[model samples]
Target chain A: MTNETETEQTPEHVPMMQQILDNPFLLLFLGVTIPTVLYILWGVMEVASIPLAD
Target chain B: MTAETVVGVGRRAAAADFRTCPYTGLKVDAAAQTLIKANAVAAVVFLLIGGLMGLLVALTRWPAVHLLPADWFYLVLTGHGANVLLFWIIFFEIAVLYFASAVLLNCRLPAPKFAWLGFALMVVGAIITNVVVLQGESSVMFTSYPPMMAKPNFYLGLILFAVGALIGCAIFFATLAIAKQERTYEGSIPLVTFGALTAAIIAVFTIASGAIILIPTWLWSLGLIGEIDPLMYKVVWWAMGHSSQQINVSAHVSIWYMVGALLLGAKPLSEKVSRTAFFLYILFLQLASAHHLLAEPGLTASWKIVNTSYMMYLAVLGSMIHGLTVPGSIEAAQRKNGYDKGVFEWLRKAPWGNPAFAGMFLSLVMFGFIGGISGVVLGTEQLNVLMHNTIYVPGHFHGTVVTGTTLAFMAGTYLVLPLIFQREIVWPKLAKIQPYLFGIGAAGISLFMMGAGTLGVARRHWDITFSDAELSFAHSAGAFLMMGLNGVFAILAALGGAIYVLVVVGTVLFGKKITAGHKLTFPLHAGGGAAVSQYGSHATTKLPGTIVLVAIFFVCFVLYYFINWKYLSELWLFR
Candidate 1:
């Protein structure tokens, strides 16, 4: 994934997400993060729907 | 080179490459290092989440500060149990397996890709389970008992995790085989690796039991199966549940020895005796699962007696042997280094400033004194009935799992960061004090919980005050005080845990890196090579200090064991 030609051709700074994706450890974090965010959203929705008892 | 030769060449190149620790001179394969890092990182993350949940649970139990609502209390309790008990520990155990097998044996990992697959499955499964638990439909509180059902994904997630762990176990075995075939080290494996081998073997049995039970539970959750017998489910489930802690006992005991060696350059006092103890664990440890089912009416007395008395004693004997030999080994090593004055001189001369040594020694003492002794008492059929579903059960496990296993893992991480990751530990001052802070707080938590349990605090109930119940019951005021103190100690322990996390994460992310072949400047493990595996000569160099400690342990164990019996006797007098 580390390409010498590509680096030489594009000598500008890369985006932060691209840098994170390049690192395997950071990718592992991302793998867990997506599902966690979705789960949190789902949890918020579920709790919102619960009606208060009289 | 051709494509075939290119692949072959890469394989050969990686296999030929190894890095030797400048301090210990042990060879570490690159791929094994990757797996260890991945697993250890995941373990610490779970520890953070679990510790937070535990703090909430403790505060909720406090009478003066009933924190979370009942629903949230049960939910957080369930998450705490799953993350800390299963996820945090097993992830670290996988790391330990890789380190003990491939790194210790000086062999390359046989299937690095397959190992990654296992890691991915485990990560996915753990996330799935956490997600489901947070969804609030799966707060069955770790046990997920038959009559109370959780989402099917909860059971499915657990099954996937178990299968992933089974794959990791298989890789450990295969790595061992590769070491043997390649003749990496002569004779039998090292004692620490042997201990890890015991844990892995027990893991195989434990995971098999989990699969056997969780598979059906998954089906039942999906409505594919009829009613599951609650008693039958409990019997088989504990075979998975309690036996999993048996895996923890084996792994952390192994870490005790490993950290002893890394810190003090200590060897097992008698390598043969220690290895035999590990062997004893593999043979009889799973039978200790009977303690969880001791109060179940469905199980026959004969069955209970055989497991708790006949076989479980052997498991306890195994732990007793480890309790003696680990500190005995440290004392023997210290004496050999000419600290040969009085009984406590070797102990006094030990490198207590080193966090690794301090954490390990505290773990050993607390584990043997409180955890081991209380565990045996709680395991007894007669005494167990008094405190079966009470707060005492969690008290006993917190002593073992948190104080014993988690502390050992934390101690092991100190050395691991410097040695394996080649990072100079940041926050050295805080690192030095972290162990004691954690140890004192965790010990306080355990003692107060046990005290509360003794005064009739219910285990799973969120409110100690029976304000909502029709038939109200009142516990002693001391129990409320104990719960309050438990909350304070839990906060202290969480602070300690946070300090550890900051020190480790900060060091790994930004600390000075040691180049390959450069000697590490860390003062941990500053002793000479004279103590590394010093076997067969001056084996028993007058460890009166360890003898006294062991004697103290036994005396305390006897007192506690009988006190429980006395309490049981007072319940119904024949007079």
Candidate 2:
């Protein structure tokens, strides 16, 4: 809740968790980037470095 | 002044192309509504085609039946995998994404024309792929591994489909921004919308992966390149192929929560906990793609262990959280309604008659017990070695994708008709029983297929009998019996699917209109979500029933894991 709605009396108050939750862009960025690094990028690196079969 | 009355598009309904739902009071936009309807209708049409193809494939796999010829079997199997797994599911998901952002948030959809273009591209792409598969030249199966090349159009179809999906994800994100900037709802988005956000984020990653691999493969198919490395294609393709399962989970989990919320007035046991789980859910599910590559010698031991074994469990844990919380919240709400006699009274008194509840619960249970637990075993590098090419692999995915994800979507449609389409559902009796019929049948298909696979039935063979070969060998009698049972279950599941299509399509076409003050055919729980529906008190609600259910799940998981290891040891010891 914000002063616009102003349910709580705490001035300019929004929990850090609430702020993060409200930010869809930030969530999308982290969600896409994290998985890419851990899964796709990591797997690509390994595949790129695969030595020729003996 | 109630939270429920703060409509999304209805906020500015005087000027915009928005209408308020007579039942739920959410502001619905005409553009969003049309998009949702088109995508959903397309999804169902694909489902009908794909499901029939699956039935043919299953009958062909059953030696006693062997419905299709070898070439036709491979062709239908290819179409089945792509249609049901890719097209049907993604189309429905795009609909959900639109609904969650635009309707739930009470915001207008941005760039409606572009969204239509995206949908057209997807439909066109799906048609092209299906046409190519039907042409008898490109039966590479769903994975489409290299050297076994398909026509360039096949890969091109998939790439276009991926691009369309990416656009859909973008529209969802854009809708979210419009909602926030315009101040549709206060504080954080609803938990259902948050879950949708998780799914769309994953969709982007999954589609991007498809683009990365499929574009090159498309060129190779055209002879623009000499060849694609088998190992490289295998690894990257699994990223595109297997990781899409995560998209299904994320989307269907959103559906579960949405269904639970709408039908049963169920809220999560802990909002923060469940959202955290969704965060962990998508993050780790991508890592679980490593299981597909576990058998590849080119990938090392340490890589498989860290990614497949350790990190994959995080995905399992996320699902486990959802599995527990969904029912826990439901139980809490049920008990709140004065069904609080004992541990199981809430469970016993649930709306088992409602297709939505029944389907959602069945999906959650099947996904967790049969799908998730077995997945844990198969995702292990050592266990994967035993199960990799066996029919058990199909069995496991059948459990997840079919019973888990597909059933969830099927159940959600019961509600989708009235809410989105604003039409009454016909055939109340059939609607009541469709979930059980489909669920039991599909679960049987998964379990029996797994049973045969465990006995070392080959996964990728049109003929296990080898009737044409010079030398004929036979699997154990038990393997044959399990497959025979699989055929039977496929028939039952197909029956249920037909009923679903009839009821949904029939209702939308001819059922009574849901105008303002219309009597809703299937009654919703009166009032808003069981917002404060926690048991005991708000702080430390005790979910005794859910806790007991989860304990049983853990016991089953541990027992199954050890059993696989013991089975592995027996092979070596006996030989």
Candidate 3:
């Protein structure tokens, strides 16, 4: 519980994963964005794989 | 922050004041409790309706009974799916979201009026859909795949429901904000709440996908638009359908954690790892919606493989982590309580007599061994061909949804009765036996369905016997027997479900009221002191018993997964 706004401060070490986990909003962004990209890619690949009709 | 200074001293909202629960010493907001009560009661009503519809569907599938005619069978099946899969689960999950956010956090809910509006819309939508289904104009089945369009009201009803649920999710997020801004509690939220948050996040995406697909489909149904491509419908539709089930997984898993802490004062062996697993779910869980698309053409193998495996099954890795940690936490708790004699003593000495514990434990085993293993098999692109559109599909979900998620919900309902509803369980003796009755019957339904499926039982077909066909087709004797057994199991499961409804409704209606001074149904309840310190440094706690159980699970998973491949290979080999 180090103070960041104070003039003299002692910072605590936090792991990157813990930082992400601690912030639900960050995790929410990744959760939604990642899946949306994957889904679009899946749809795009399917459309691309289709042969042009004669 | 003393929960008074950072937050207003009192009267945030007209209904925002909190009363501390006598059992747990947690502050319960009046508005939030009312909403929880409303949503939970609605969930039970829908469960009764859906469970009965399921019984009818099962009986019709049984071949021996063949209860309903074709039209009615499809109608009831759709109702069963909509009511149980969508309505019952989502309504309860709304209650869960509120409970997890406000009740668990000891904060006042921000918008009680909006929450009620959401609950009202859900109820209205569910009723509208059920009415539409029963009117015999909409038998499009649960999938309601495009081109086989139902009445426009059916789609309309579903849209209303999704909108309502989305509102519920909004209220939940807002409540979380209020908690944070008010400084209700310090540090990270509890694991149970984290798990609920995961469910809520996925739920938003799922309901949005539903809105995207259903709104257009509804317009199409009304002749207001052009044709909907079947393939496109399947893709977007399962984004909603499959992801909705993912919400269930997250919610029920949260309940499992809550129950563990409540019952045994259990703490997770590794909070970091468990939270990481939930994070993995958020990232990759919805991508597994591709499992349904595996059998469809025009989708490339790369797309199929990448998505269905959830990017190397990272989502599955999430579930596996939960599977280990939930019970491991309980084991660790038991050890702390001096049940450390051997590998099995913790499990052995745990309260099996407690319906909540028994049902949750059964749900864990069945979900992992049967549901988890079967799901991976079904998810495999190559192997899915063997079981695609077969009874095996339903079999797999029954393992997960019914035996796993639904059973977990029922188990948690016991706690809800004692804690939230403030009622002692009626027929305490019957309550004790309910979990086993339900668990075994559900396990039977899953197994028998899979057996019948392996012998090539069609999923949505009206009759397996083909009595009126031009060329009379016959399933093997074993398949016939398995369907018969499925019917038997359905009755058993119905009895189990009936017992639940009877006891719960009876308890809610007629049971003695708890005034907090009285002992709870579980006299030994730890009163939630365990939740305060839910994480441990001991990620590597020795649990040889759990190791052996996990080994057996891995073995079963490997064996069953390959056997499907073996069956698939048999299909291609030319003699």
Give the winner by TM-score: 1 or 2: 2
**Cand. 3 TM to true fold:** 0.95
lDDT per residue (tens digit) for residues A1-54 in model 1:
469777777756655533432232333233223322322222233334446469
Ranking by TM-score: 3, 2, 1
lDDT of 1 by residue, B143-216 (tens): 98979999999998899899889899889988877776676654456667777887887787778778877999
Assess each prediction's global lDDT (C-alpha) against the native.
Answer: 0.79, 0.84, 0.85
Candidate 2's residue-wise lDDT over B1-575, tens digit each? 11222344234434448887765667788899999999999999999999999999999998899998999999999999999999999999999899888887767888999999899999999999999999988999999988899999999999888899889999999988777667676556777888888888888878988998899999999889887988777777777788788889988898888787776667667777888888786567777888988888777788788888788888788988888788887887787778888789999988899898899999999999999988999998878877888999999999999999999999889888998888999999999999999999999999999999999899879998888889988899999999999999999999999999999899989988787788776777764333311111122376788889989998999999999999889775753
Listed in order, the DockQ scores are 0.01, 0.47, 0.45
Off by over 4 Å in 3: A1-9, A48-54, B1-15, B310-312, B532-540
| Worst 10 contiguous positions by lDDT, candidate 1 chain B | B1-10
Give the lDDT of residue B360 in candidate 3.
Answer: 93
Query: When superposed on Cα atoms, how far off is each prediction in RMSD?
Result: 14.0, 3.1, 3.0
Number of the top DockQ candidate: 2
TM-score of 1: 0.88
- Residue A18 accuracy (lDDT) in model 3: 70
Q: Tens digits of per-residue lDDT for model 3 on A1-54?
A: 245456345455667777777677777778777777787546755765678689
DockQ score, prediction 3: 0.45
